[model samples]
Target: MATANTLERIFSVDYKSKIQPIVSLCIGGWGLENLSEPNEVTIDNSTGNIYVADSGNNCVKVFDCDGKIMFKFGDKEGKGKMYRPIGLAICRDRILISQSRNCILNYQVNGEFVSSIGKLGKGELEFINPLGLTFDESNGEVYICDYNDNRIQILSQELTYKAQFGQDNLHSPLDVKLTKEYIYILDGSNPCFHLYDYNLILHKSVISREHKLQVFIPFFFFIDNSNNILIITDYYSIAFLNSQLELIHRIPITQPNGVTVDNRGRVIVVCDGGEHHLNIF
Candidate 1:
């Protein structure tokens, strides 16, 4: 698909007003909140915080619920082997980081290092390019999206194996987010999404752009307070999906990666289009 930044001759529809679009809400009311090739974002309700995986910075930037950068963590220059860090999930009081280096570590709310949770290897509980992590708060289950292995592994809070879903068939599962009962996977290579129920049974493929199975690669996703609307972001656009997994409305953008919803239900999208775009509306 053509975008506003690439291949100038390509066509696009702004849908800025035809779809009753509203102006982009001024997040934090001001400041340069642009990002470089952002990868993931999550909203923490308890702390009223919004976290962004500033992958290019090799650090996670925590912002106030209103989009103000509160603090920055991790080394950004790819120093200390924090190169291309992925996966971030907030447990009760700490954050879990799946470093591309050798292990996933936890940190306190003050950005103090806690402890390493798992190692990186080919064996059990050993991760090779682990990319995403989520806490199944309902069951205290820890789910990991191991990209290199093309599998989503389920483990206990103690990091013990419970089950593994999607092995050879998964095409680079990128990020995962779970609710009380369902697990969502973003398969980038195949450019589709998958959902599994609590029993680990495949509920169905959620997002696609291919014919008869057309779905887009969802880099990240967030559910509203009601769990009725889903904000799915990929490299090129942000799409809003209904609870049934139907794309109710899709907004075209540049290289979008990080996404989240504000208190007012406004969508905050960080896009990397050379201009460092953060399109919110």
Candidate 2:
């Protein structure tokens, strides 16, 4: 492969052990009655609570660290009405959801309606199909993936627009993660992910196929405690990469869609292709 300036190529990656699922979740009603289409999964850093955006069911399911179904919100009724909710992120005491609206809805830890962040527009403090999002807990900042707008917007903890980036190579971006050192964006385009600095400078685009892997469809990923990037691809596997963008390990999974890491660095994946259930390793 040619040595590109932004996206470099690697030939081989270390294949680590395939961690088995410690717990599998299938919590809901029954017989196509619950968890119709779960789009994303997130973990509460403070409490290790698992939040699943049950889109088809028009609700958000909360699970404890042990995979026990705690409670659910957003039943299309009151303040927690979730219309096709797709994304989820938990920072501190707040739960952020990106659903049918162009804005991001917020709720307290107890599932009480709190406030919203952006609106439906093309400008700052405005969003178009806002999808995955993450929080910079250290600096009280939120990084959101404005999917249709092809940009990533940064906002203060108070939901004030700070800055935005990725107008050049962000085509259908899905998830946005903010680590201690860099901003990881999963675009699902040619260059699957674009890693940038805090200032939104173009650092490098991490393409999954560069390593000659079978990652045809890259969905969601999260950074572990060791800063390793765990990516869930469409080919029933998880690719692990180091902070330097080098592939380190590949774990086998079963048609995983959304993935996150718990407080204990366990891999939590939501599989919809097979059983439409959630699994934790």
Clashing pairs in 1: 208-214, 208-215, 208-216, 209-214, 209-215, 210-214, 210-215
**How well is each residue in 1-281 modelled by candidate 2, as lDDT tens digits?**
11101101212322255467778766434333356678788877667788888877777888888877788877456545678888887767888898877878889877788776667888998989888887776666778889889999888878888998998879978887765566788887664778797667988876767754335677777765344444554547777766665666676766677787655656778877646778877
Q: Backbone clashes in each candidate structure, one number apiece? A: 7, 1
Alpha carbon lDDT at 233, candidate 2: 49
Clashing pairs in 2: 74-80
lDDT, candidates in the order shown:
0.63, 0.72
In model 2, where do residues sit more than 4 Å from their true spots? 1-15, 27-33, 78-80, 212-214, 225-227, 233-235
TM-score between model 2 and native: 0.85
Query: Which candidate has the highest TM-score of all?
Result: 2
TM-score per prediction, in order, is 0.77, 0.85
Off by over 4 Å in 1: 1-34, 75-81, 210-214, 225-227
